[model samples]
Target: MGSANVASTLVYMAERCTSMRYLKLIHAHAYRTCLHQHTVVLGKLFRFVAVSPFGDLSYAHNMFDQMPHPSTFFYNILIRAHSHSTTPSFSTLFFNRMRQNGVAPDEFSFTFLLKSRSFTTPFVYDTHGAVFKFGFSRHLHVQNTLIHLYAVGGVTLSAGRVFEDALKVGLDVDVVSWSGLLVAHVRAGELDVARKIFDEMPLRDVVSWTTMLSGYSQAKRPREALALFQEMRFAGVWPDEVTVLSVITACAELGDGEMGRMVHRFVDENGFGWMVALCNALIDMYGKCGCLEEAWCVFHRMKRKSLITWNAMMMVCANHGNADDAFRLFEWMIDSRVVPDGVTVLALLVAYAHKGLIDEGIRLFESMQRDYGVEPRIEHYGAVVDMLGRSGRLQEAHDLLTSMPIPSNDVIWGALLGACRIYGDVDMGEKVIKKLLELKPNEGGYYILLRDIYVAAGRTVEANEMRQAMLASGARKTPGYSWVEA
Candidate 1:
């Protein structure tokens, strides 16, 4: 027991691994001892994730299934992980899977699940059944979840039904319930009704203010959101990370850097340093607000910077076309042991490809599987095709196209056709046009690309024939798109 306890403590400490190599070593040791299951600490989840990093939801599902006796707690952890960087469906699918396994859900399960399903997928019926099945229909938390599910799930009428049910059952109609309905009302474009609920609530928290602020913000009521934000601040309700995140997002959309700076001061004064999410949000806010220096400062200051943190920061470099700086940061990120996933790869590849750095693109791409253990997904493949096609190595691009196990889809074909126009390979262009026509027989753009290739090669007859085919297909390309960079 002592040995197991000591090992668990060690596993807990391993979650603090600052270096990627150390994280991998800790991950290996934990997996060797099967501490992922035996160790009940939440940090084990991070270990499982560190060993089995991004773009693979299958591993998380597999581990969850292998657990000796999975609890709601573990299920919640896995569900949230699966939900993010993917879809809410990941969480909902597993929730159903858990039911099939005869594990009853608790209030927390419904809460998280409801939170994941944001005003989408009509789960009100299933949710109601789950409540009755679990005999938690009368439980305040369950009712709160039911209200949340319908309100967020976009079934405004159904949410009202749940609220009516809450009233009939004499359940405690507290702030949470009203908040859900208020959000629903606001979502249904009933901001006036939402405001009514806000005024009627006997008590309000920072979340209440944040909710109204978000509602107003989304509805283009920034003045109202800011006004309510001021009113809430005067009410002495301490703002939370949620409030800060929402306000920062709003400020970014409006390009309100000064307002964002005000929020930043509040965040700093409140000493919310441990909230890594807020830290990342601060970085994102500054980046969007055109404060890259401040964004960089926040990124380095963050005690914990998730993959998104790196991606967000990397994007600023990518946008500036600071290819050298972007590549430098990307190299530093991978060297520091941060696992590069599809987003990381795609962004950096774009920078390299735009800069005509073909060698660098291929090297980094090949290292995905050989060095990083990340299987190249379709997105990665698309980036390579785009990179090579744009660099005028159409033949190399065409050769590489045949090697992918995945079919050469529209994206690849589009890149090839684009390269055809740039490099004017009429023969390859003609061949690719057939492939494109086969896929999009009615798409006028394919014929236009073929015509453009022929024109560039001074093959007037071929260009005229392709134009005739466009007339035959009754498909026409939209006006040439303008690409202006400041």
Candidate 2:
């Protein structure tokens, strides 16, 4: 076959080789054509095997070893594969092998190594030393990856240092580089630093705006997020699906129905309503804003729904204490053959607990493991405990609390304590109060509950004793406050 045919065959294989069998066929064809050693052919094959769904790093490595003279590109290909694979240590292994084989590394090699999510800080910094030795430290791609690595590793100081070094070396600071530093500060909870970096940037794109908006939302500063989102709009930067999602969430946190409606209209006006993620966020936002009808309309109007869309709709029902509707949605989800996950069951459990459906909640909790294969997490246990306790099944609640596989958290014990007060069982309340105090002796909340129980029972002396204990522990309940928009 001519070289042209061989090149075409390699391109076809790269595009269509979905399974190992197909890869082997291509490998055999390459060998027959004596194109196995061809750099372009081998590079394409190595890259496909490294990332294909049917690709195996071990098999790809063996293929590379068969080459009489493997190029640095082949080594880099394998290194990038292992860097993302579960066995990230293999990346280092292959890097060492490349050095021993006298194959020099390139900028891509160092960047991909740093991109490995599984790398430790010590290993990353050691690799940084290699980047310095190779004199690729100032390579723009390498510097960007370093900042990202430090940012994700929560080593914000190191990321900032790298940024400063880039400035010193006069490397052009691209938007990606600025975004990396912004992310580093945000992850470190230094939003002030993040905001400063954001404001100082000469240019801002949708990404830059979205990053700050997401940072504020995650940090529970919803007002700030909304404010920045408005600034993004006024600056004429178009909001992507991600930006809209963050903005909708901030509106939800504020429970601003008017703002939620405006966002909903904006989504329709901007033709972003087709994105299922944006629609799901709209459902959640409307639900939180007490617009159940609007939330339902969004859910029903969507052309397609992801699992999250269904989950969000169900959560809306659960939030409104509409247990029947929540169950109906769960049934619909099952009929649609969208397998229910732990979050699905969690929402249902909250609904059951909210409506005080003790028997139903218990049945669902038991069925979660057996029927749906969803393991019982701490939140699930808390929901069941709350369900039983609220329905006056104090003994059953306490029995489940004591016998559950996981250690009981304060929510579990607090549920039982509240039940003890409601049932007027002074003896049980006293016993549970001792356990509670042992768990958190300095917690003013539990102390207040115990003292209230004693006072309600006309046990003045015991109430006084509980108050003294609270004073000795230096625990006091801070006054509750509310915000009004008047």
Candidate 3:
């Protein structure tokens, strides 16, 4: 074949190469045709093996090592691939080698390096310096990546400076630049500032809208998040899976089942129903909305269930007081070879807690670290304590609290205190209140709870004394409010 035809044929075959074995055959063919030495041919082959689903990084590395003169493009492909790998530090190592080989690093080189998950503050600063040295500090893509790196590191000031510098230099900052700045403020919990920036953006894409929505959802402003979703739709911006996930989470928080159903229907109609993450979010939304049947329907319809999917369904059952179903799901999860993580075990423990299965709950709690290799967290301890307290096992619950490896928090102490009032154990109540006071001396609610306990126990003198103590402490009881969806 002619050289031009040979190169075209090799490029076509390389594009269709599905497996490493097939790729090797193509490489061997290129070698026999004497085109393997061509940089373009090698670059094509290297890119496929470095990034394709069936590609092998180790094999790509070998090919790179054999190249007589590797280009910046070759270095970039490897660096980008490694940036998402388990050891993202390899991305920097490749960059160092690229510099050593005298291959000029482009904006993409710095962009991928800044994206490395192994980034520390010092590493980020070092990269920021390199960006300036390479004169790529002005490149919007590189600048945006630096913004994300700074934001994630909680350096909102530095991130803002990068964005401002871009604007000062007339860099034509786009949606990504705005989104990166929004993320910086959002990560710092400065949602108001983020919203102002979002509003000020000359143009907003799905990413800009999603980042703002996620910030609101994560900051526990679910109502605002939903309102923004309405605005997003009205602005004619189609929601991606990520956008829908945040909206569903907001709906879950508000317990707005009607809104959840609407989001679910949108997912189905807009071709987002196939995403496992969206399905998982839908299950959680339905579960929190007290729509167990709807949660179950979503669960059963999923063809591929992740560990999170099972945990969400199990928690749904547990939340609705369906302990038996939760247990059944656990068994089925085990049969399906989906190993239970901390969340899965926590869901089962929550089930035992709600059903008042004291023995079962205790057994599971004890075996958590030993059997499932999942160490119990504070939430697990809290669930078990709440369970024991509910069953009037105040002493046992108190003992568990004190004996826990982690220090007891007000919620655990409060659970035991509430139990003491229920069983009219004045002595235990006094003891629990003392511990609670030590933790939260100015908490008026704890004092009020203790005063109520004293009144219930007919200890009028102590009740009067507690009332005086509450007034003297100057601690105000937080007003209670309820949410009613209109």
What's each prediction's clash count? Answer: 1, 0, 0
The global C-alpha lDDT for each of the candidates, from Candidate 1 onward, is 0.74, 0.84, 0.88
What value of lDDT does candidate 2 attain over all alpha carbons?
A: 0.84
The runs of at least 3 residues in candidate 1 whose Cα sits more than 4 Å from the true structure, single-residue gaps closed, are: 1-142, 151-157, 166-174, 182-239, 247-266, 284-291, 330-339, 407-412, 430-450, 458-486
Report the Cα RMSD per candidate: 11.9, 4.0, 3.7
| Candidate 2 residue-wise lDDT, 1-486, digit = tens | 688787787867767778888887888888888788777787777778887768877788788878887778887887888877888877787788989999999998888777763364354788888889999978989998989888876789999999999989999989989988998898899999899999998888898899899999988999999999889989999998888888899999999889888888999999998999889989998989999999999999998999998899998898799989999999999999999888899899888877877788889899888999989988888878777777878778778887888777776798889988887777777877787878877677787777777778889788789778878989766355111111
**Per-residue lDDT value at 314 in model 3:** 96
74-111 per-residue lDDT for model 3 (tens digits): 99999988887777888989999999989999988998
TM-score of 1: 0.58
What are the clashing pairs of model 1?
119-152
TM-score for each predicted model, relative to the true structure: 0.58, 0.87, 0.91
Writing each residue's lDDT as its tens digit, candidate 1 over 42-155 gives 346543552345323554556566677777777776666654545777778878877888887887777667666653466557667776777776777778777776676556
Ranking by TM-score: 3, 2, 1
Better of 1 and 2 by TM-score: 2
Off by over 4 Å in 3: 117-121, 335-337, 369-371, 471-476, 480-486
Displacement of residue 470 (Cα, Å) in model 2 is 1.2
